[model samples]
Target: MPDIAPQPGVVEALGQIVGARYVIGPGHDQEPYTTDWRGRYHGRAEAVVKPADAEEVAAVVRFCAENGIAVVPQGGNTGMCGAATPSPSGRSVVLRLDRLNRIRWTSRLGDAIAVDAGCILADVQRAAEAVDRLFPLSLGAEGSCQVGGNLSTNAGGTAVLRYGTMRELCLGLEVVLPDGRLLDLMTALRKDSTGYDVKGMFVGAEGTLGIITGAVLKLFPRPRASAVAMAMAEEPEQVLDLLALARTRLGDRLSSFEVMSRRQVEVIAQHMPDVVIPFGLESGWYALVEISDTLAGDALPPMLEAVLGEALEAGLVGDAIVASSEAQAAGLWRIRHSVSESSKAHGYVVSHDSVVPLEKQAEFIRAVEAAIIAAEPSATVVMHGHVGDGNIHVLGILDPARFASAEALRARAAEISLAVDGVLAPLGGAISAEHGIGVSNRERLRRVANPIELELMRHFKAVLDPQGLMNPGKVLPDALPA
Candidate 1:
């Protein structure tokens, strides 16, 4: 909580751009914009400006820039960290883009769709499906999360195994810079060897660089036929072996591959009745494999059967179950999605969205789990994530007995993360993975980020926002002021 002076004429200036009715400030109506999704960081904004379109957003940014006011571009406010929240000093304006919700169009030839920043992810998926296309970005927050936040974070969901993250799915973006200049880099074409590729920069910037207003996203032919198989393994290490064998056998047919721990599975089973574990026998770790095809033919079952047979013979998978019906496939996916909610229901936990190189995934998981358990045995460790992409989400729960003083446990968990990240550094893995380096992970960035890269990031931020008017305490480390 550093000191930040309130900029003059902030309310009047923004009120002139977007009507005063849409501008929220210093009142009960503005409370929600002052905090983050997790309720971890509570910020204070001079005003919350809801812009109806890209032009309105541009105007608001222009007014703020002229007055030397800071701006925090927010979407659905569904981010885990306080990346989208404003500062507590009340010097910044919260520019919410929810009013700009729109689906422009879908391109058949290029297999891409244009969407406004405020468009809900689930709605985008439905729009894509209307054109007989599949928007492969599937996450727990799809129903409520806005496309802008997802694009800003370069969100990676279950489908990252085949389709890739938001960075890979995004073709172009329309961004408004800190100085109020708009850069429309919306190229629907896939093969573009253009200069610099500026759109890619804003994808994972976490709104520190600029505000992402809209995007052209990659889409695929809707999967006409698909099969889901739940494979149980005696050990977490065997999940990697299972993935290796499936990748070889399934080839391009693989759609989704996720790994879940026993505790993670049990939590989902207990909380969500609709989502039952496909297999009754309890295993240490499990793999959820999805094989799909675009054409209207049921080739998924046979291919899955062949792969599972090989996996069983190789002693890689302990047990397996291929969903005989579509309802069953949805049930399995439901179980996978419930992991986060169930953990939250239990209590406070230290979550890490870390990733290692694919070949080193199992080894990384084993070493990190052992180290963490050894250090904090009473902690309920719920481990799971997009194993196909090597991103392992490790959640360390606090001891129920030590309910009143959880701060000590949280500090110890962070120390464990530092050690785990240290082990992952040599493998060229990211400590933050798909989740951007918000205020929460800023210090961790300092620890893990290369010094040269850190310097360059600071230099870039200075060049774009010389006065530090954009999201000030994000992405970059706070200790080293730019």
Candidate 2:
């Protein structure tokens, strides 16, 4: 924690910008912002500031900068890491962007749209659809997560196989600097010849550099026809052939290709009974693929069938089922959606957001799972993720018999993660794929991050937030925001 607490006039100064009623100080009003979505990281803040607009936001930031109060700019508070959660020092201020939720307008051409940072992802998607366009940043938390948090963390969702992550989906952003200056880099331009892509830096910064307020996002023509299928492979190795076939057959139409381990699907079935697995446990590994195209016709179904039929014949896919209708397609997706939920329901699970080379993905999963189970036989290894893009989420579920308390299990999970990440690193993979390096991954980042790269990040942090007041404890080491 920084050597500072809330000054004498800190609360009064913050209240002046957004009103005392919105400035939550102590008691239950500030409780929600103190903890993360998973309840893994519990922290505290001097106050929670809810500003309705950017003007109020600037003022609040200015006040905080003056008072030496750290700012944790939060959007939906739906992040996995403790990036949004305040630290235990009780000296920082939690600045929430929920009040800034607003959909300004969509361009007539439907290529771009202006959205406030606090806009719910689902609302943004709906707004895009109203004009016959598509906001492709789809995630499980779309109904609750906000756009600002998505960009801040540079979230990678199912569509990253085709559309890309939140960083690529967005074109422009409005960020409030640590010094309380509003840098309006908001533009819908696809091409910009600038000295440095400063806007890009803040996209995945996790609020270490500054607070993201709004963004101009790129939109695509809504897919008129969508085809979804769930296919099983005899082995994880065979799934690679399926991926190559998908690219060759579907090309641009191939939107998402997610692979799930048999254990992951089985756990989902055992825990989440409502989320029906369309294709039962007939094979070792399963894949859920989706193809979206602008062309509107019944031909997509046959084309998908032909692709799967060829794979089936080639011995790449064991068995497959293409959804007959939209409802059926959504049903297939429900199974994919239930992986994380079911994994968490059992007990403390150490989740890893990692990616390996496409050629080594299968090998990585097999090796890591073997290593984990060998270490803890009772641990349920839940594995699945966007196999197309190489981003795989591996979870290590703790066995209650082995560990008496959640703390002990969680500590061991971190140790296992390091061992798992070590295997991933040599194979041209990263420990973190989409989830950024917040406080939760600070230690891992310190261990795995390149010495030069980590130094550069430290320099950037110092240059941006010289006083270390903007989200101090995140995306860095030894700079805890108290």
* Best-performing candidate as measured by lDDT: 2
| Colliding residue pairs in candidate 1 | none
Tell me the whole-model lDDT of each prediction, alpha carbons only: 0.83, 0.86
Q: How many residue pairs clash in each candidate?
A: 0, 1
Q: Tens-digit lDDT track for model 1 on 105-224?
A: 998777999999999999999999999899999999899889999998989999998999999999989999988988888779878886888788788888888898999999898988
In model 2, which regions exceed 4 Å deviation? 1-6
lDDT of 2 by residue, 150-247 (tens): 99989999999899998899889999999999999989888989789999989889988988899999999999998999998988788989999989
What's the distance in Å from true for residue 147, model 2?
0.7
Worst 10 residues of 2 by lDDT: 1-10
Error of 2 at 233 (Å): 0.7
- RMSD value for candidate 1: 2.4
Count: clashes, candidate 1: 0
For TM-score, the strongest prediction is: 2
